[model samples]
Target: MGKAAERFVVEGLVEQTPAGPRLIGSRCRGCGTTYFPQKASCPNPACTDKAPVAALLPDQGTLYSYTVQRYQPPPLFRMDGWEPYLLGLVDMGDGLQVMGMLTGVKEQEVRIGMTLQLVTEPLYCDDDGTAVLTYKFTPAGTAL
Candidate 1:
């Protein structure tokens, strides 16, 4: 879990799973609304119980939607300069929608239903030279 922890958890920690690593989310045992990395407060109005039990989310999924960011995004990240990046909404089969960049997808090839796996990538930097790693997606395999 060396690299896995480095990517998933900044402290290089991991909550091991038989499937793989994942950021644990909370499930509303009362309303059935699932959240990623879990929510301390329940989004459901019907259930006031903020007791969000931690649950590991599914990692595999098909691309639900996608886009390309061709400009510099905002700060609070380790990114600057102009570059084209792929953005997408991934459906991990459990109704979970996750957003990330395509680390594994090179230019010239991106499509809907492109299978993907989650990966953490360098966001951007300020003047301090600290790298901000954020969760991003990559092509499940060679997209060629």
Candidate 2:
């Protein structure tokens, strides 16, 4: 059989874990602040700390805010099938708030403060037929 066609949408952002897929981030060693996409150095202007440690964020969070994008995005962003989708920011209960696409829930069905969990799905297939996986948030306990 041919090898499974799979790849991450963005490297070093999400990782497979024993529990499941988890978002990867960096934590500021000086002030205990964490950020997604893994900041190279502390963003805080007041803090002089330059060191950050790799941190894995919780898969679950609350829907803090959201917006629906109905139009096709600009260049470099692939859209195999253009359709409106929910884009939201989730409060990870720490000081970090992560932004990602929302899936598996209708726009009308979404509610503020809704419990959500992280999921990885194919964003698109490349020319070689490798699936590019990206992280998304979904209403907790809603079947895949």
Candidate 3:
């Protein structure tokens, strides 16, 4: 019934997709401006003439770049202790890009231009003990 309550009800990785399983985003048909997670505003001032339109994010893309955070990102995360992890940005063929955790990795291994997949992670727990979540990209395929 409350914000916190509502968030908890819908918390966790939404394996299911309303519009579709593929990522969804918005592209300003006016100025070609793009937004991730979708938005209701045209970020481009030139395109501000009208409300930002809704669009589905492209599912297929190449790994533009990647890196491993040896240090914990901080309080916003909960994984027992700080674990050096991998993170990466996926360049959806649609010109829109997304950042996500780099799963399917081998210790001390990372490469750019690799394929990726979206995986959700728990952000933190609310006072009511509800766990917040976020999506991250992980490297695809089993590690050698």
Candidate 4:
């Protein structure tokens, strides 16, 4: 068989660092605000500064909030085996909060103050046999 294709769900979102998988974001030089997906320009309209530098956020964070997605998401959002999944907003310190799926535990077991760590998991396989990966937050110390 040919080599299996491995790809990120969204390019430039996750990076393999010495510490572990960290989410990539942009920090504005003007307001010092950070954003995921790496914004090109600062969101603050008051500041005219155009410099936004890349930042790797901390992998471990606390669960700020969460909800269970019961319905199937539309196309382009690949959930191979659709089911209710837990999604949460994580506080990565420094005023940086990230929204991602929560794994490694049942939906009802999730709590507001639980500690979580970043992990890259397989979302789905493409027609070309490529494994599409996405970042998720699982209970700290759980194997990815």
Candidate 5:
């Protein structure tokens, strides 16, 4: 068997650049608020300018919090290796906190406020041999 062709879990959610993978988001022109998964308009009630533009989120952040998933998720969610994993809420600055799977560190070793870098890994391989990729957070400096 060879390496499988890769595809993101959702299109337009992430992009590959010369630097690395970047999350596609939106920045509100009114209040300068940023959002992940990209929003079509600013949700802030105080802002008058509802226009939002596409933006790439930072690839690094601080681990604000985390939790362990001891049980397998619903059938809609698939993983190649079914095992308990850590989920983290990462603060990417500018008041943006994104939740994603934690990688490259054990649960006992994970620490709040630790630096983390954005990464993508295969969640599962489809029957057609496509590796479904999803964004994750790993300890900074960990080799990809």
Candidate 6:
């Protein structure tokens, strides 16, 4: 049988680059505000330009805050090996803060203001064996 194909959990949310995985977002040309998950228009009330262009967010950021998910997520969320995981809000500069699953570092070692890097890992496999991928943050300089 052929190897299982990999796919992102959500399309257009992240892109694989030569350097590494990068988040796909939108930036306002008028006020320079950035947003994740991409936006159709600028939501800033003070900015006049409503159009937003696609932007690749920084690959690294600092952990702004975090929490542990001790319980299983709702039915919509799926994981191959379910376990308690850490979730973090990372500050990616330009006033942009992104929330993503934290990996590599132990929950007890997690700390605010720790440097993190963007990475992709399989969350689960599909019925056909396709690997479902999701973005996650790891301690900067950690080998994947």
Clashing residue pairs in candidate 4 are none
**lDDT of candidate 5 over 90-143, digit per residue (tens):** 999999999999999999999999999999888999999898999999999993
Q: Give the per-residue lDDT of model 1 (tens digit) for 3-41.
A: 322232144222446554465567888777778765778
Candidate 2: worst 10 consecutive residues by lDDT?
Answer: 1-10
Assess each prediction's global lDDT (C-alpha) against the native.
Answer: 0.65, 0.87, 0.60, 0.87, 0.93, 0.94
Residue ranges of candidate 5 with Cα displaced over 4 Å: 1-3
CA lDDT for candidate 6? 0.94
Candidate 1 residue runs with Cα over 4 Å from true position? 1-20, 80-82, 124-131, 142-144
Candidate 2 TM-score to native:
0.92
Worst lDDT run of 10 residues, candidate 6, spans 1-10
Task: Write the residue-wise lDDT of candidate 6 on 1-144 in tens digits.
Answer: 127699999899999988889999999988899999799999899999887999999999999999999999998999988999999999999999999999999988898999999999999999998999999999999936
Regarding lDDT, does 1 or 5 come out ahead?
Answer: 5
TM-score-sorted candidate list, best first = 6, 5, 2, 4, 1, 3
- Lowest lDDT 10-residue stretch of candidate 5: 1-10
> What TM-score does model 4 achieve against the real structure?
0.90
Top candidate by TM-score: 6
Tens digits of per-residue lDDT for model 3 on 1-144? 225522322422243364324555667777777777667777666664645566666544577877778887665456534577776778887577777666667545666777766544455566776655556565655322
Better of 3 and 4 by TM-score: 4
Clashing pairs in 2: none
- Considering only N, C-alpha and C atoms within 3 Å, which residue pairs clash in candidate 3? 23-57, 24-57, 25-57, 100-136, 100-137, 101-136, 101-137, 103-138
Off by over 4 Å in 4: 1-3
Better of 1 and 2 by TM-score: 2
User: Where does candidate 3 stray beyond 4 Å?
Assistant: 1-15, 18-21, 107-109, 121-132, 141-144
- Report the error of model 2 at residue 6, Å: 1.1
lDDT of 4 by residue, 23-135 (tens): 99988887788888699788778778868999988889999999998888888788778788999999998887889999998987899989999998888888987988899
Candidate 2's residue-wise lDDT over 1-144, tens digit each? Answer: 127688887799998896778999998898888888788898888777767888999989999999998887996777567688999999997778889999999999999999999998788889998888899999999735
